[model samples]
Target: MREFSEDYLRRTRRGMWDDSREALAPLALESRSRILDVGCGTGELSRVLAAESPSGAEVVGCDADSALLEVAADCVPVVAGDAYELPFPDDAFDLVVCQALLINLPDPEAALAEFARVSSDLVAAVEPNNAAVSVDSSVDAEGDLERRARRAYLDGVETDVALGADARAAFEATPLEVLETRRYDHVRTVEPPYDEGAVVAARRKATGAGLADDRETMLSGGLTEGEYDDLRSEWRQMGRDVVEQMEAREYEREETVPFFVTVGHV
Candidate 1:
């Protein structure tokens, strides 16, 4: 499984459930008595689940990372455990769900099986279709460059990072009965009155820090060293353009990541 830093989780999941949560309707949170959020990371979705569910509902977060669990503990009850082997008895929860978790696992089906074992009623996954991501930016080249970089990353990544609506296949492989799938677009926007994080992101782009972090994955995906250099060169140039636009307070960008909420009955 892949690991993520607390900062990465926070940045990517910022404002996720803030706008609307109609897609979460399938989870039927109001009546849920016990909910377990697998691979909860910093507990963004765990917090949301807790808030949306009935006041007395028990919401627990489980993760392999102890450090992340420490952070998540601030929000809800947390346990350090692997996704495939949860540290709980069978039928421990009424609803077992994960967000952006299955995409990083080599065997999502296996994990779903475990989720079914633990959940007496529901199993849900909230995964993104990375390939379907759309970006619009004031900097004309930014959108195209982002797509190119994403394509390379997806091609090279080991896990099925693009597992979105297709999560039904994995659920079908388990004992759980397939339920409904809902599409939710998580939009991240950067416009005037840029926040501190936005400014720092521009700086990271200027230094190609983000691309550098994915350099190994891009290379493993068949991107040659020379090709990577050329791409990074262009990427840095684009970043500089973004920085310039930010300086003028004219930078605007909206990135839409389509997430599929797949729910199943165990």
Candidate 2:
């Protein structure tokens, strides 16, 4: 599985629930008594789940990473456990769910089966479709380079990165009855008066360190060393151009990551 820090989780999940309540309405979270959030990470979704859950509702966050559990503990009752083997009895939860978890796993169906085993009511997954991502930038080259790099990255992802769009089909094959599926576009923007993180990211790109750091992940996806080097070269050039634009206070970018919420009756 991919390792993530609290900061990374927070950044990626920013504003996820801002206008996403409608998509989640079918879950009927308020009526759920025992809610188990698997692979909770930093508890971004768990926090929202905690809020949506009614009084006395038990919303417990669970994950395999002990480190992440520490962070999640601050938001809700957190248990360190594996997704394949939840540390609970059958039909223990009224609702069982995971966010951005399936794409990282090699066998999501097996995990869904486990979710079915633990839940008497509902099972759901929120996953991203990397192929459906869109990038818009003030600089034409920046957008083009991003698309190029993203294409290679998507092509090489070892897991089911495109699982978000196909999650319903996968869930339908399980014992659970499919209830609802909704797509939410998560927009992350980079605009003027760039913050410390944005500046640092720009610097990393200009130095080609960002692409270099992804060498192994890209290789795992099927990118050749030569292809990687070429990508880095072009990426670095684009980054330099971005720096120039930044100096002119003319840099802006918006990236959209399409996510799917698939809910099933267990």
Candidate 3:
């Protein structure tokens, strides 16, 4: 499983579940008695599930990270557990769900089987199609460099990162039958009145302070050292331009990530 910090999880998942009610409606979660959210980190999705479900529904969150579970416990009932082996009885949940969990797993099909085993009614997966991400930035080089970097990162990923585009195959491998599929577009924007984190991130990019962290992964993914050096120089310049625009209060960027909500019935 992949490890994530509380800050990273919060930043990436911001505004994800805000407008996802339509995509989540097929499962009829309002009537569910027991809703289990596997691999729940920071309880973002679990909070939404709890709000959508009936008053008596037990919307629980489970994760392998104790620290994250501790944070999640404040929002919902959280348990320390792994997705491959949930610490619950068979047919223990009327609905089993996970948000952005399967794409990072080594064997998503096996996890889906476990989800099916624990769910008696519906199983849902909310995952992103990383390959189809689109970016529109005020700085042209920023968009281009981001595409190049994303390509390198995708190549270096050992797991099936594009699983959201073809998740039906995983369901076919399991005992559950596919019931519905819905598409959700998550749009992340950085504009005027930038937050403290965005300002800090732009400054880091301008100084190339964060480029070194991904250097090893890019090198292994066919990005030569010389090419990386050149990209860093350009990235720094673009970041500087962004800073200038920010000073003028004219910086804006929008990135759209397509996600799929696949619902399966046992």
Candidate 1 C-alpha error for residue 184, in Å = 1.3
* Superposed Cα deviation of residue 240, candidate 1 (Å): 0.9
Score every model by TM-score.
0.98, 0.92, 0.95
User: What order do you get sorting by TM-score, best first?
Assistant: 1, 3, 2
lDDT of every model, 2 decimals: 0.93, 0.85, 0.87
Enumerate residue pairs that collide in model 1. Answer: 156-221
**TM-score for candidate 1:** 0.98
Where is model 3 more than 4 Å wrong at Cα? none
Model 3 reaches what TM-score against the true structure? 0.95
User: What is the alpha-carbon lDDT for the whole of candidate 1?
Assistant: 0.93
Model 3, position 182, has a per-residue lDDT of 83
RMSD of 2: 1.8
When summed lDDT is taken over every stretch of 10 residues in candidate 2, the lowest stretch is: 14-23
lDDT of 2 by residue, 104-196 (tens): 888899899999999999999989998888889887777777777777776667788889999998898789899889888888788899987
Give the per-residue lDDT digits (tens) of candidate 1, residues 157-252.
889988996998888888889889889999999999999999999988888999999999999999999999988998899999999999999999
In model 2, residue pairs whose N, Cα or C atoms come closer than 3 Å (at least 3 residues apart or on different chains), thus clashing, are 156-221
Arrange candidates, best lDDT first: 1, 3, 2
- RMSD (Cα, Å) for all candidates, in order, is 0.8, 1.8, 1.5
Number of clashing residue pairs in every model? 1, 1, 0
